[model samples]
Target: MQPDLTVSRTYSGPICLQDPIDKELMTESSLFNPLTDIKVKVQSSFMVSLGVTERSEYHGKAHSGTFPHDSNRTFNPIHAKNKAAYLQNLSSLTKRSDMRTTGVFGHLGGRLGIPNTGVSLLIPHGAFSEEASWEIYLAINQSEPSLQLEGSEILLGPEVTCGPPEVTVSTPFALTIPHCAEVNPDHWTIHLKKKKEQGKWEEVMSVEEETTSCYCLLDPYACHILLDSFGTYALVGEPLSDCSVKELKVAVFGCMSCNSLDYSLRVYCVDNTPWAFQEVILDEKHQGGRLLEEPKLLHFKGSTFSLQISVLDIPPFLWRIKPFTACQEVPFSRVWRSNQQPLHCAFSLERYTPSTTQLSCKICVRQVKGHEQILHIQTSILENERDTITFFAHDDSHFPAQMGPQAFKIPYSIRQRICATFDTPSAKGKDWQMLAQKNSINRNLTYFATQRSPSAVILDLWEARHQHDGDLDSLACALEEIGRTQAHISALAETQTEESHFSYSRQNGL
Candidate 1:
């Protein structure tokens, strides 16, 4: 039988205990029951199904390239019968508080090169359950003492696993709002800080929510956080304050099927709040015309409700749906809006036929419309067994986004997931619309052409010819073509200018 593993919280080092009696109890069946003799086999089989071997060691061990069930040993009839039960137990184990993780924890090392409120990270939607409490531990070299002024303190254990070298002065900052927001900017000042090598945090200027210049807007209380080498950010505001007009918390998603018209919205309410919500559809292909729908007053007792909107009711081509909500309570009343922080889902619509091999999409989360922060990309692959639901997060600074004119970045470490079911799982069948939903909130990602930076990449024909000798002739020919193209552009410009002057004189009857 496999060793019955036990990890004691108090044990500082690896403790190898071989208690004969305990071992017998774990492996051998009780004398009172004869049919329960196969319990050990069932337990072992279940462990294999859950991929427990992959997470057996406190520090992740190198993968063996084969799972426990991948062995040549034949399974008994009883092991096969209890497989479903084993899978359920494995799922529970993953949710346990003490579950081990393989992620690297350390000081997020990097320097801030952009403006004070520049976005260094982006955490997209569908990353975690709406009810789950998530925390990301960051070890920076500096100390922003101002963060201690607002939210409650979180005490981290001195014993960090796979973290950076010890540093002086550690402060725990709260990511979520603790109480109602009765005050305005004073409620909680958002600080932009930089960590110096001498182990000190220097304060950067406060970001403007209304301006399109800021990087990202954070909802400190939200479960999502994107980390980078340069900095970490949290949303700090009273979103439901009396000074703000409440915006609806809604997620729009389209099913992946052969049908083009089917789509749905998941309306969210926190802890049974009474809400008045409305949706206004606008036609963009035709002259901007608003198609009004009756307002919905929902006393949401449940956490969420998935509502399907019929496509026949709205215009085709390009359309914008406006969703707004109002509530009477403390947390539900404060609805804040800024160019850097507008809550909406931007979906890229595509229709997939049955002949399509796979499903893929590029997902992002930005502060609002126009300002886009690329967060992640998802692509589905074919498999025999059903895909297990999973979530992944990382501090990838290379995520693709047009930060400024000519400034473009790409996804660093692309996170992957194989979900057993999507938000709209039934829409997975063929004949559905291929929609890539973008959940951008709390950051200005607007693109301005006039103030854009020059992204000119200089190329050297000599270096190209030397490095790629096989393409030397091709490189030489390309350079010649480029030189000729410049002359053609100059000639075209002169022709256009002469034609404009002649037309101007003719129109004025000069």
Candidate 2:
């Protein structure tokens, strides 16, 4: 199939060089108006460059939010070093009264393309002092995905030597192109050219090396073209007429939780333009995952975070499924039933590892004009424990804990002691027990070790040590009144840890 030829250019036109001395727009008053100013003799012509468009003679109304000016060579600025100097000079021009009056200056841009689109908002070097800064800031934050303008290009002088304006885009960069450009089969080669000293254009030396490129027409209104490089000789045709949303991708940012869930959604609109979704409708009907409210409505003013809803886990927890509130302050009320049941529940950090469940749903995003855009989004919801717990290897060195392939999520506190008791289990089950005996048993660390597999010996040691401590303090009246035996003491220690685990996980949203 033939590729589309969507061409964008910088339309340069001559403006009056000198402002009339008695023009009403040039008054000394602070309220300034340039439209009423009269033009005098042109000492030097000012060329204002609007983002250009080469449209088909047939389609008069181009698509909205598509920027064709980015494909133009005449509007490119130089590298960062030169751009900084140009910005500085431009700033000086605005500050100095003599520079404004000494020679003729022209307004370099106008409203030609779609209003509120990239081309309409983009002000080249000839526009204002902060225009360059704004472009740079916009490029970094990229607050809007649809309204992107290539930063100001260095305006060349007659004497300045120059090469072709080149932009090396990744092989899959151009997401969509206009329909008219696609009809011609010869427009696929990624052109490489340079500007000559005499103001003529010439092709750069093409390497015989077989470089690769990709072009995919998404639909009738949009086509994706990936080019290795582009130059002044490379021309595009009119953009596609209809605006569309090509695809939507969603992913879980961190951990999924039964208590609370977080998901990130990225909407890839057609033509790589920034678009604001008027309303996002989230429907949880017929889906295993349930929402606090059915058909949740979210509002956004051109922001990616259109819907961020969190709800407490509502389903009753099954046996063996640790609940988030399983702590001393709020004990887990386990139903005593022998029958096996599925327990896909999130729990306190001490009892279990948080679940990382992936959930997907198709959502409807409404545009400002009541147009409904449907998108499919898949997100991973993570309910991970958020403490940093470290274990020293046999060599007595702190090492990161790792499972088969992924790094283990650490708890809040650091545990870096050697469990020497593991060597001699005669009385103390593990090295951590012996260590706890010497350095008092901290309720939090001991409980953490108990939760993991093959670490029960470490937990036994902690229990033994705590019991020994409580036995020695039996003379206390409170201990006597509690009827706390060694077993009761062990439960107390467990309860203390459960309280700590609940507090830690809830605070950090692990």
Error of 1 at 315 (Å): 38
Residue 437's lDDT in candidate 1? 12
Q: Could you give candidate 1's per-residue lDDT for residues 459-504 as a string of tens digits?
A: 1112111221322233223222322343356568789999999999
Q: What TM-score does each of the candidates earn?
A: 0.22, 0.18
Model 2, span 167-250: residue lDDT tens: 221111121222211232232222233344364655332211222322222222222222223322222221122231122211
Which ranges in model 1 have alpha carbons more than 4 Å from their true place? 1-205, 209-232, 238-241, 245-495, 500-510
- Candidate 1 shows a clash count of 28
lDDT (Cα, 0-100) at 500 in candidate 2: 99
Off by over 4 Å in 2: 1-362, 375-510
* Per-candidate clashes, comma-separated: 28, 42
lDDT of 2 at 177: 20
